[model samples]
Target: MASSRPKNAPFLFPTFNSSVLPDPSRFFSHDLLSAPLPTNSFFQNFTLKNGDQAEYFHPYIIKSSESSISISYPSLSHNSAFIYEAFNADITISGSDEPDQHSRKTHLISSFSDLGVTLDFPSSNLRFFLVRGSPFVTCSVSSGNSSIKISTIHAVLSFTGNSSSTKYTAKLNNNQTWLIYASSPINLVNDGGSSINCGGGFSGIIRIAVLPDSNPDFESILDRFSCCYPISGDADFTKPFALEYKWEK
Candidate 1:
């Protein structure tokens, strides 16, 4: 299948190697490479890294040939009001060759208290290895007590399979089912620890906001964060990205 390439960005994708890719006949059903992507939403494009070795703000899941992991982010728009409430969020991340087996699962949902905000990935199959090319949201519960954490992360997809959408079904704590979508066609590739795409060059930058005029320990607050820098604009800095809570009422 021929890939309709995007205009090259400043950075470029790594050289493609047919040797490491899986055979088409064994893993494909259709030509997903020509499938259309959802408009406005950027595709997650990058390689997976081990959790301990990844930099802060760049969270990811270990790749597994047997099973693909699924993630559901809070549904909100880029201009939606930022989260300012005190609620917890949970994330369930996992990866494996066989998701049905209990033994292959290695990750689970992690609870972040006081904030009611957690990013859960099942601890049974994969580890959280965050990287750049993604941005996380933050919130202020009250004066003197604010929290900043990852709310979203994305990467380009690559795999050894026949034509497929690369989506998987998983249930939430409420027993609700959601589809985890992969950045199909693998439009990007990993290069020197960064996500490089055909649209441009390597830009492993994730946007973040610092509380406005609220004199606090900025460095300490962002200790786990790296490669973060300020983006100048007239908009209020207190409000960074949009958010929605999944906590119980």
Candidate 2:
């Protein structure tokens, strides 16, 4: 008339226990502006798993794992070219050499498990699409309403299995300025190469809307191009130009 059971036994029947899944909405399409793209700029939408969508300004999207991606539009004062940067892992480029070929194009996408960085022209605009990766540090300069500001981001995947990407804007400002997004973290230095105290950051999707500097004071700007050589074409896909970060510390 009595029944006995194991105190620590595994369940054999299907249980109603539920597990929490990651929500892409928190990180993607949270507060996007419906404002149209400016001249010489375009908007491209990407569909992630679960059918969620995110829109990016530039044509290229840098997909990576184990490392973060950085796309730079070095200021006109520094240079007139675009840069694509990645660190701590390997990646590959997808999309077309001439994305302008179509107005709204969607390539054969897959599960977000591969690592790749899409490289486009040497034009003055650069954007980054970071996949899974470790903490990456980088900075950027933005100008708004005659005010110039430099900011940094420390993007890291935390121990809680969630990602952290925070943008820290610098307090400095100017009347008219040039916006520069470094392909890598920049170390500010004096004339003698002594390091300055500019803060550090991590590489993440650059969401700042960047416009080409209409005016530049070339003389006052520090020279970071002595180590980089120019590529002839408008960034030929077969022979894409590379700009190594001169101030890696």
lDDT by residue (24-82, candidate 1, tens digit) is 22221133323332222111111122211111222322222222222333332343657
Q: Candidate 1, which segments miss by more than 4 Å at Cα?
A: 1-94, 104-107, 116-124, 127-134, 137-224, 227-249
Top candidate, metric lDDT? 1
Candidate 2 lDDT over residue span 162-222, tens digit each = 1121222221122222222333343322122211122342232232222224233441231
Against the reference, the lDDT scores of all candidates come to: 0.26, 0.25
The TM-score of predicted model 2 comes to: 0.18
Backbone clashes under 3 angstroms, per model: 53, 9
